[model samples]
Target: MKTLAIVGAGPGLGLSLAKTFGQHDFRVALIARNQEKLDTYMQQLREMHVEAAGFSADVLHTAQLEAALARVKETFGPVDVLEYSPTPSITDVASVLDVAPENAQFQFDYIVRGALAGVRAVLPDMLAKGDGGLIFTMGGASITPTPMMGNVGIAMAGLRNYVSNLHEVLKPKGIYAGTMSVMGWFKNTDETPARIAASIYEMYEQREQGEHVFEV
Candidate 1:
């Protein structure tokens, strides 16, 4: 079975993604910083009858992230799909970010470079085979710039640019690259995760390359 590796896997959209692809026979690989959390996610996928495994690695470290992907490939075979969902380390994230602009680098490291590591780990093989899929969970700060999100918005903006560039360059090379830009209130829209997951699957099915925007 093909493998789908979800970096920064967590409870909400991550679990929805796991279920959506796992139910369709994709070997789900849960990648996260917490092994215990990964274990829980693994159990949940197993309960749902999905072949799944847990992996732990700090996304900020490219070497560690690449190593984790290598291990996944060794165990489950080449990753057919890569889902990157990065979270900022800063808890009290605010719109006015110049107060501690340095924090923005952390976001860039995890969100942008972290994603690059995953892509580099799998791109060669995909290039050789001439097909691949890359999906990103993005924020509203990317498409619409707000002064309040200056810190994270900087990194998010970079991520958005990279996603667009990658789509332009690699789509013709058979890599399906896109972003799920969440601009809505996820808490109020409980079903948004499922909808996003389904939309991701549809994008892959159609080999679509572009931004898939949603409020959730």
Candidate 2:
């Protein structure tokens, strides 16, 4: 069976992505840092009759993340699709001036670095196969910077640029790279997650070249 590896399998969009792909008969390999939480989620997938497993790993550390990916491959087969959607704590920014230089690196680490690690983990196999999907769940701050989210805005702006450029570079190599930019608050409603997941699958099927914006 084919595999869909979600690097940040949490209760919201991550789990939604799991089920969305799983419904289409994709075996799921969920990756996250919390074993207990992931185990719960894995059980839920089984209850739904989806072939699934969970692996614990932190994206900040390359070794741990790569190891988890290796195990996923060993268990379910090479990951046909990779979703990177790690949520980071946002530091409020009242103004553009409020964003400190020292804090910039931390923001970059949260979004850019984490997403790249997941891509790097699976890209080689995708390239070898001559096909794969890599999707990032970014947000509105990356699209239109506002005073309230100045800090996160600037940081996500960097991530937005990186994902866009990477998409261009990877597309020719038969890898579809894209980001789903959410512009509004994500409520924990069943419809929203399912809708977003279905949209993501559509984007992948279309091999979208850049960010797919979801505005309020």
Candidate 3:
């Protein structure tokens, strides 16, 4: 079975992604910072008869993140799909006027550098196979800047740009790269995590390139 590795996995979209792909016969490898939560997530997935495992690693620490991905490959073969979407702590966020150098660096490391590490860890295998998917998720601030999300927006915008370019460059090589830019989370609408995950799966199946936006 193919493997889907979700970096920065959490209870929200991460679990949805796992279920969506696992149902389709993709063994799921979830990477996060907390092993306890990871165990809970794995048990939930097992209850649903999905082949899933979890690895604990912090995105800010690229070494641990890369090692986690390496473990995923060792356990489930090479990762056929890599989804990098780690949620940043609210404390790390700051407005444009108030954003500090430390905050900016933290966001950059969490968002942009973390993604690069993930790709570097998995892309080689994907390229050798000539078939794989690289999916990235970011907030709407990445597309349309919000002053309140200044530091995060900066890193997110860079991520979008990087993924966009990667999509174009990898298109001819029989690989898929795309970005999902969500503007906001509307609680009482059709924009649930499962729905968004289904959409992402659809995009992966279609091998669509560039960005897919989910607006309010």
Candidate 4:
């Protein structure tokens, strides 16, 4: 079975994504900073008859993140699909006026550089195989500027722009790269995690769209 590695796997969307892909016969590698939570998620997926494993790593630390992906690859073979959606630390978010250089740098490292590191870890193998999927998740501020989310917006926008370009560049190689931008609160009725995961699964299967904005 193909492998799907979720870099920022959590209890909600992460678990849903695991089920969506696992149900489709994809082995899941859940990556997060908390081992206990990861274990819990892995157990839940297994109970549902989904093949899943967990890896502990903090996105902000390149070594840790790369190591986690390395373990995923070692366990599940080259990752056929990589989904990156790490949530930035609260301290990284700053208002427009209060966005100091340090805060901006932290956000950039967390959102942009961290993603690059994750991609680099598995991309070489994907390139050699001539087929793979890359999916990134970000808030609405990434595409639509929100002053209240200054530093985060700046960082996420950078990632969004990069993913857009990556989509075009990787197309010819039979690789797919896309971004999912969430607009409004996901807690609302129209934006449940399971629903969003289904939409993402469709995008992965179709591989025609470069970006999808989940709006409620």
lDDT, model 2: 0.83
128-192 per-residue lDDT for model 4 (tens digits) = 99999999988999988788899999999999999999999999999999999989776523338
lDDT of residue 135 for candidate 4: 96
Model 1 agreement with the true structure over 1-216: per-residue lDDT tens digits:
889999989888898999999988999998998999999989998999999998899998888899889989998999999999866744735566463656767677877889888989988988888988988887788788777766777777888888889999998898888887888557414888888889888878887657887765
Which residues of candidate 3, in runs, are more than 4 Å off?
186-191
Selected candidate, larger TM-score, 2 vs 3:
3
lDDT of 1: 0.84
Worst 10 residues of 2 by lDDT: 88-97
Worst 10 residues of 1 by lDDT: 90-99
Score every model by TM-score. 0.93, 0.92, 0.96, 0.96
- Model 4 residue 186 lDDT score: 62
Q: Mind giving the per-residue lDDT tens digits that candidate 3 earns over 46-162?
A: 999999999999998999999999999899999999999998877788999988899998999999999999999999998998999999988998989799998999999999999
Residue 169 in model 2: lDDT: 92
Which regions of candidate 2 fall more than 4 Å away from where they truly are? 91-95
Between 1 and 2, whose lDDT is larger?
A: 1
Clash number for each model = 4, 0, 0, 0
